[model samples]
Target chain A: MKSFNKKEFRHGLKRGLPIAMGYLPVSFTFGLMAVSGGLPIWMAVFISLSNLTSAGQFAGTNLILMGAGFLEITMTTFIINIRYMLMSLSLTQRLDKAMSLPKRMMVAFGVTDEIFSVASMEQGTLTFSFLIGLIIGPLIGWTSGTFLGALICTSLPESLSSAMGIALYAMFIAIIIPPAKKSRPVTIIILLCVGITGILKYLPLFRAISSGFRVIIASILGAGMGAWLFPIDQDVEKNNKQEGVNQCN
Target chain B: MQLERAFLAMILMALVTYIPRVLPIVIFRKEIKSKYIKSFLQYVPFAVLSSLTFPDIFSSTGNLTSAICGTLVALWLSYREKSLVVVAISAIVTVYLTGLFL
Candidate 1:
């Protein structure tokens, strides 16, 4: 209870509201997919509650439904969700130095792609309460969407479910657009990475590669290229940190 | 038997995913000093998300037109800085309407 910081908590909850809305249609589709694949509604909700990573959960569910080997499930999930490591690292760079170890671990559980993107753009050093508030919206939305999706998939028409499929990608594109326009390096990195992914996806040899590995390799290469060409100025970093500390006070 | 396997798979999936997210935050509590690593992290989201969005976005729905139109609308809205909820729901509606005609 003492952990609650009302102002930051309110801020985070507000921030999370949009993310929660975005997660609804996407996770609704995930629920439909899950129940069709033979998961019980509760189990689908359980997965949504426990594993917030969308791509990882989809792959893991596919395997589990197939009765794939545990080693396979683990290995597949590791490959798919490995990008979160990079995201977490980036967010750690963005976090307040005073944010504690226990707090870091707690928020780490909620580090989905959308959450990380939104949090990384925060202007100030993060407080645990704000972080919890941020995590809570998506957590509830994802779980409830799953429950509703599983419950209603049998009842919904095919066209409706299919239309919902595009919501996640639409949200991702929405997230990147502002930053892409604001930063030249980001624009170039996005173009280069999308091109690389296209090559990997379409070319005969690389088409066989799993999308998980493709994302990992493409992401690292894109970031590496951006780093090589357009490193963030140290003056800027210091300035941002100064602003963050000032905001903290 | 199947349920047990699914349960185990869920647990394992949770563990592996959790480790990746937790490890980096716990290991790097101090301020990062390296410019290269910092830059890499800075650009990771754009690059990863760019790759994630491509090709996949174009084909997520049944018809190409629905995906393409919805994506175009989303790009336009988000560029104008619409709320994410607005952007996503608008695109969803766009696709739904497009689906009716297609």
Candidate 2:
């Protein structure tokens, strides 16, 4: 509570800008989808404001639009969001131990894939202020984009919006490709994930698996294989030693 | 009743989503000891992101040709280590321009 690092926050904001921009088109599409599917504009915006998750909220909204039961929506969202468990757990390694429970809880609220990826790649431990700064822009981008898309339903040029459908995925590619190029283990993991996902998606026998589960299954298998193939013992030892020092600080 | 249903659904969805995010950060304060587990966590982001993107990316723009063009553009830019914005915007522009012909 005493240390509000404005510099770190500003750095976080700067780092988050691309994430916010990436979110605009995707959330805009979400807004358009929810409203067009007959949800109220306010409700669509509310979902974006509260959920802050891309795939989970989209799947949940689609279910609501289709009159799916509460249990179904809840389970589907939980399955899709379970990936955050890994992201959040990964983040605990980098978090400044001085960060309070309240701060961790608050920061955890914004741990989307993009934010986590950025934070994980950071050279040192993460601070609460930096995380807060990182979360705010994308949050605003996501909520406001949803509001605009809900309000401006169908008016935006079809080609432009359709083209925008690739924005989030493009950003994902941007985040992973560079790292994969440098690291052989990461390259193998990416290939494994893509191959597994393709088979699950295309093979008639596995087609019954939901998209949410597909991501979870693919991640576990891919990461599992990577870990088995390339155990990063030195990195873990260094990280643990660093965390111990941070805790003492 | 309909409004109530939507409200309930949104709240439930938000709750389910938040728990997965918060629980691990809050509960696992200590560092994981196992190198394999650490490696798995390390690789999680790339794997999750890759799984999320593929096949889905191919269908993202609603036209296979445009989507492929965009994916190629994204791969090319990102391979060169372009910023996220540059890669994304380039792919989007490529998709839009490709869509014109399709």
Candidate 3:
């Protein structure tokens, strides 16, 4: 048991390190945007700490800038983040059966795409230490980056800040490219969503809908289509592996 | 005063964000038994990722040229299975420099 616990901890930290490294630049941009958009450094940090979601934070910040109402922002965020619910659902099946409710809850809070990918890739029983490692590494990296970016924003010139802002979009391109190559459905979804968003942004009638609404509508439409086209087969190997690990324990 | 209002707004935004993050963990503690629900969950990530990527790819600026250039560069790198960091940095640099020159 002791050896098993140690191994899980080590593996968790190892997996988390790369994620933390990636999050730094991304979170830094989020912090910079938050401050530039007139939020206080503390407020920026608080938002990053509490939410820990990049795209949603960016969208929320824009909505605030656009003078969106409280209800609008809430609904927008809910729609955008509804995907996490799905991620958590998938993760529940992967979790160790012996995991306590509290531990499961804590781990679920940290279920981002990167964490989910790393966790899903693990070959054996999902341990609490592994989830802890995933959360701790990224949490530290993300918060530190936000702090650094917020502090630097005041010192930097507008032009440089704007240039650095390009990194966020760059990160998105990075995310979209890999899956797009392997999955025609994914590529088509991106193209379709982009086209629809463009049309909606330009059309006179759609101008009445807030950016938040537009995003929610676009996400629902795109996600619905993707789900219809490329369904995921639940891997029996993963379930069998978990069962085998449990029997050994 | 407006800053304070924005601060309040930021807090409100954070609260709203936390609800989605925390709710599933709290509400759906058990493994979902329904095959249909599982199937739906499986596709949610792809869809959300697509929607998130789309607007940013095009609307980073009012102009379509930078977006087009960026997309072409990104597609090329992605097709090559280039590292995400490399693809992202290359696209941004391509677009930013293009904005300056063109």
Leading candidate by lDDT = 2
RMSD, candidate 1, Å: 3.1
Model 2 chain B worst lDDT window (10 residues): B1-10
lDDT of each residue in A110-148, candidate 3, tens digit only: 877666655654665678887787688888888889988
Q: How would the docking of model 2 be graded? A: medium
| Model 2, span A160-214: residue lDDT tens | 9889999999999999988777677888999999999999999999999999999
Q: How do the residues A1-249 of candidate 1 rate in per-residue lDDT, one tens digit apiece?
A: 355689999999999998999999888888988998998888999998888879999988988888789999999999999999999988887666777788889999998888988887777677788889999999999999989889987757767777888888888888888767666777899999999999999999898889998988999999999999988777875564344311210
lDDT against the true structure, per candidate, is 0.85, 0.90, 0.65
* Candidate 1 off by > 4 Å: A1-3, A237-249
Name the candidate, 1 or 2, with the larger lDDT value.
Answer: 2
Indicate which candidate wins on DockQ.
1
Give, for candidate 3 chain A, the lowest lDDT window spanning 10 residues.
Answer: A240-249
How many angstroms is residue A22 displaced in model 1 relative to the true structure, after the best TM-score fit?
0.3
The per-candidate TM-score of the B chain, in the order shown, comes to 0.93, 0.96, 0.84
Model 2 stretches astray by more than 4 angstroms: A235-249
Docking class of 1: medium
Global CA lDDT of candidate 3, please?
Answer: 0.65
